[model samples]
Target: MKANPISPTIPLDAEGVHHGHLRLPYSRDDSAWGSVMIPICIVRNGSGPTALLTGGNHGDEYEGPLALFDLARSLDARALSGTVIVVPAMNYPAFRVGTRTSPIDKNNMNRSFPGKSDGTVTQKIADYFHRELLPRADIVLDFHSGGKTLDFLPFCAGHLLPDKAQEAKVFAAVRAFGAPWSMQMTEIDAVGMYDTAAEEMGKVFVTTELGGGGTSRAETVRIARRGVDNLLKHAGILRGAPEILPTRWLEMPDGCFCFAEEDGMIETTVDLGEKVEAGSVVARIWPIGRTGSEPHEIKANISGILVARHFPGLVQSGDCASVVATMAD
Candidate 1:
């Protein structure tokens, strides 16, 4: 593999707090000699565990970036014992315009992991993380929320990994983060996810799906803020006990979602956190083109709580209507 063109403006290995950018050369029609400068903050003390905290995996999500940007500005190096690397906006291009994928290459950053070094803008960013940043971290927290297409109940989540020991650690971290709900997630596609990359590298990885709708609420932002602090505490990177809170455990299995069969205006029958039985109608899609036609019903495939739902009023064919996650005993 060729060396990534992305270069960090701050020293990765140091004994104090540093704020800089991950500069990547980019040439476009507007500026022939322009670059993408991704902001980064590294706070390190004496040798200890390093926690890599990232946000804006998808440009539309806001909770992670809001919390992380605050952390970058307010975190004191004197109050830390390890390294805390914060990248508030991983996809700077998309984040700037509030899109889910990078505007430069129309590439979804979350799905472009372990990317080609000499590829497009998004691929180069992923390659930089894969080859350079991920190798130095002992624990990784990549923040996510339902973007413009969907909305979710605030929750901290971890995938059902093959490694039980690693899974245990990851779940423990999720518990320590203390969101309202703790989830054992099932990804529909994990081929090149950043989650898969970090977990494969044996790093304790935990992610989140706070409230969505392409925006952030103060409540969701607080959850993100407290969760990151608690994670640092749990990793022994910061000097404090994790503030564990009571959380309902949820399990999302594959195919636990209901999809819209036809495009129309979606009428949600169930709200987030509401429970529904299998085969129950979760949403109805009414045709806007013709008023007299019967609406298409979208039903739940599992008996569980509605954890996610599409955000927009109108729905296209094949859009997810709702996602149900079973209660964990």
Candidate 2:
């Protein structure tokens, strides 16, 4: 493989506060020698574990980016024991346009992990993270929210990995994040996911769905800000102990998701964080083509709490409407 075209302006190993960009050259219609400059901040001190904290994996999600950018501006290198790499917006183009995927290649950033060196713009960014950034970190915390298409109860999460010890460490970080809920998350698909990439390297990883609707709230952002500090403390990268909070543990099992069966106006009976029983109607899709037509009812396959749901009013066939998750005992 050829060397990656992306170059960083700041040294990744320097001890002190440094800020710069990951410059990737892109020759487009506007300019023959144009480049995308993604903002990054590095804060380092003495010897300790590195915590690579990132946000804006998807463009529309704001909680992660909001908190991370604040931390980058306010964090003092003298108060740290190790390095903290902050990339508030991982998909800069997508974040600039406030979309889920990159505008340049229409590829989702999270799904472009372990990417090719010579590929699309999104892929190139992923390739750099896979090669340059992730290797230097002992722990990684990526933030996420519902974005425009979905909504979620504020929660920090980790997957059920095959490595028990690694999973334990990941879960410990998840709990230390101190969100309202701690989830054992299972993605519908995990191919090329950033979480997978970090975990495969045996790095302790945690992610979050703080809140959503293509926007963020004061409470959620507060959770995000505090969570990052908690994680650094948990990793021993910071001096203070994590601020402990009560968090309900939850898990999403297979068949717990409800999907729309037809296109129409969506009517959701259950709200987020609400309880529902198996076979209960979680949502309904009324036919837009005509009146007096029976709406397609989306029912819960298992009894659990409604952790997430589609955010918009309209629904299309095969779109996920609701996700019911059980209490993780």
Candidate 3:
């Protein structure tokens, strides 16, 4: 297949700000649908390694994209070396509608990696990114947050193996993030995931899950901004002293997946990152009726730290209730 046409690059002032767009094509029948492109603002000084910062891959996760917008507006790239390409809304269609997947394709852009040049809208966008943007990046930081119905504690996800030299860099990036929790993810390949593909290509990449559902959290945004600054310093793109974090890195020797035992309204009694012992009551499920029905108590299976919890109050039978990371003793 012929290479997709490169979008025009718009140059900004000497301060190192510019605007451009990425065009992703769908099918010929929907050619009139035109190219789906996102407005990207690039800022940097002389030619150096490029770092790509993108958000809104999952539309409902609002903070990352908004934070990228703030970074673009406030950054003075003239003082720094290397390029910073900021894509505030990667999934523009979903972002505009405050949804997680493209309304047209109903596909999660994050799951559609190395997309086809002439595939569905989501696939095209993914293909555009893989072909056009990713190859130029020396380091990538993909921002995300929990969707509308779920709340997530701030964390970083990256591969963790004993032998990879890049693992140190990944850990450093996560420590600089200063989030209380960091999850070591094993590499997987499917569609639309930037981290797995970046790893395969041997590029330095990390995915930051910053804050909970919806926007409105200043503290979360501030933390993310600080992380970006620290990463820039670490990369030698910026001249500054990076802040050291008091980080506690935990490994999950065994994970106990908590699934709902009955269909009912679920209520969590424990918070994320909380410690619980085996048989401890972590949640309760009860029928929605006003009349009191016996609430079923959900107990922990192992003594460990609760890493993830279902935020929605409603639960169905077999739905994941929580995940507990336990140390092997």
Candidate 4:
């Protein structure tokens, strides 16, 4: 089995502002010997905590990449107290094509963590992060949004980690980012996620779900930029206090979610951030072509705010229609 040929151009320990690439060798029909260079930027100053910021873990998501690209271009490396490694497009292939998974291997970068060095292109990229990047960082902020399939209210979130101390650190970072909502979340599955990998290593990890629908918004982008600055300050790598904002705390204790039972056209009555009660109808799925059949009502299992919902009109059986967030203590 051949190993991944991807390698970083910039030295991780190098000082000052430097723009480089993670060069991944490719053998395609157009250019057999050419390579795809995933852009990366590094800012370093003295001895301080390192922050690794990434966006575009799934190619369709744009807020992370947009915010990180600006930071890469605008931030001064000489003024920093520690290192900031910015990878705006973690899945460059998917990002280039505007899809959630890589076109080459159809692998989700977020689910390819602690990846195989001898695996597919997506896995290779994940392998590099797992082996070369994560070890050097004291904190990590991975940006995310709902992408094309769903929309989300702007929020910074942390998982319900087992390690009390690490969980506390992650919570602090989440609050520090200061979005309108702060989520203490539990995923349906965290087996191979990048978040799982980071949390497992006890790194202070924070992620965000800004506005979604496969595009960037002025407000979400602004939140991303402000959150990054706040995170750096909170980590003591930059000078200044974290920007204070009133954040509503939300939680998903058991990953309770609403799913469609039949394939049809969905009409969601509630919007993101709207409050709902348990057993209440959140959405109705109607017949796509025929109008005689009764619409199936999708109901919430618990009372909470509507944090995310399906964006597309059409849906398949078992597709997640909505997710609710309860107020957290």
Candidate 5:
């Protein structure tokens, strides 16, 4: 049996139409059974800087990948001045299994970046993207969602420190998302994630979390569509007034971590974007099957905007149960 090819290059037009595929190696055993090649679509215009749009790093996150598909179909190359590379699905194995990591390597693709040439499955794919795709591009827009287990409130996250100029560009691209809220993120190194890698490489990149709780929501699609349009408009690739929503972009202040004190069933008393007072109870966690049992109240650690709440009612100890964006004094 012939081994499968990896990094298959698919040619696309400005309208995002797929014309053909270019195969790239995924592993040493390219001719081995069940080996697979990742696919990328190149839409070249030769006028503007390359804008690379990627999705499906986390396979369970569907909206971003789907939105990229839509973008490839609708975008007009004649109007675009630069190259537009669309990797609709980055984690082929994860996507095949409908999970967050490569089933074969048991690795998260997002965490593995600037990968090695002679590395494992996930690392090799990351290496290919970094070497072949990233260097040629001036900007990158990485689409994402809450993953399989959580439904995130629509938002954007990127490094906010001024010294990281390319990171700042990533944030600006995210701001083009027009999400109701944009968060200046820190502690991203806590996990070796993709956006962090993008920052390290000095590439302008942004990751959008629209919605996810095992399925794609229409609202999520709508928000993602508007986000793509706005980003294109901001990049000067598209000529139109993309709708921008009233936004509340914030910075997470000191003592901002929301560590869960104990594990239990969470009951949120407020929604996303609500204001809360310091030491106020935002949610209560009850013991399993003890509805009337005395519940432990989860209080705000600092006074600020309630930017994100855990969508799943159940949580484990030390998990991020909530987030409060502290207001400036």
Candidate 6:
């Protein structure tokens, strides 16, 4: 792969607190040679472990960026034994516009990892993180929530990696985050995700899905903030014990367990954290502008708790309606 053109204003290895930007050149009608400046904060002290914290992968998800912004502003270099690299908005273009994909190229940043330097704008950003940012970390936390299209129960999740040893380490951090729920999940699509890139490099990675609807709640934001602090402490970069909390372990074994089948108005019958049974009606969709038509019911394929649901009142044929999670070992 070719070298990325995105350049950071500060050295990632340098000591002390540095606030800067990841500059990516852009050519537009208004400015022929202007660049998009993605904000970054790095706090470095002596050597222990480098924990990379990132948020705003999708523009509409606000909890990650909000929590990370506060974290970056309040974090002090003198309080750390290692390094804390923070990027509050990974997708600057999309973040600015409050959209799921970049406005410049309409590409999803999370699905564009290990990206090509010569690719589209979004891919270039991903390429830089893949080549430049990710290699400098011992652990990675990429925060996420369902954006405009869906909403989720507050939970921090760890993927089931092929390497059990790595998976164990990641799960420890996930559990340490101490969200209400700790989840072991298998991604429906993991092709070029940043999580996949980090995990593939053997880095311990923990991600989250807080409340969503293209917005955030105060409680979920608090959860995100505390989770970050807990993760830092767990990684030994910060000098403190993690807040102990009893986290309910859950798992999403199959992607087909929750999804919508037709375009209509969705009426969810189950709420997040509510226990559901297999074959139970999770949601029902009313046909668009069709009277006397029976509503189509969406059912839960597996028995567990309803952990996620569609956000908008209306639904497309293929939108995911709800995700049920079962107990995990």
Highest lDDT scorer: 2
TM-score of each: 0.99, 0.99, 0.86, 0.97, 0.84, 0.98
Model 4 C-alpha lDDT per residue in residues 1-329, reported as the tens digit of each score: 45567888988788888899999887888898988789999899988999999999989999999999999999986667899999999999999999999998999998999898888889889988988899889999999998888888889999987789899999999999989899998887788899998888789999998978899899999999999999999999887899999999999856458888999999998888888988889999998778688999998999888999998889899888999989998
Where is model 4 poorest over a 10-residue stretch in terms of lDDT? Answer: 1-10
Checking candidate 3 for backbone clashes, the offending pairs are 110-192, 111-191, 111-192, 112-191, 112-192, 113-191, 113-192
Off by over 4 Å in 6: none
Over 164-203, each residue of candidate 2 has an lDDT whose tens digit, in order, gives: 9999999999999999999999998899999999999999
Model 4 steric clash pairs: none
Sort by lDDT, best first: what order?
2, 1, 6, 4, 3, 5
- Scored against the true structure, residue 158 in model 3 reaches a CA lDDT of 65
Greater lDDT among 2 and 6 belongs to 2
List runs of model 5 lying over 4 Å from the truth.
Answer: 1-6, 11-32, 162-168, 188-191, 240-244, 289-293, 327-329
lDDT for position 13 in model 5: 37
Query: TM-score of model 6 relative to the true fold?
Result: 0.98
Which of candidates 1 and 2 is the stronger one according to lDDT?
Answer: 2
Better candidate by TM-score, 1 or 5:
1
Worst lDDT 10-window in candidate 2: 254-263
lDDT score for candidate 2 against the true structure: 0.94
lDDT of each: 0.93, 0.94, 0.73, 0.90, 0.71, 0.92
In candidate 1, which residue ranges exceed 4 Å CA deviation? none
- Report the Cα RMSD per candidate: 0.8, 0.7, 3.5, 1.3, 4.2, 1.0
- Per-residue lDDT, model 2, residue 98, is 98
Stretch of 10 with least lDDT, candidate 5: 1-10
Question: So what's the TM-score on candidate 5?
Answer: 0.84
* Cα deviation of 18, candidate 1, in Å: 0.7
List ranges where model 4 is wrong by over 4 Å.
1-4
Better of 5 and 6 by lDDT: 6
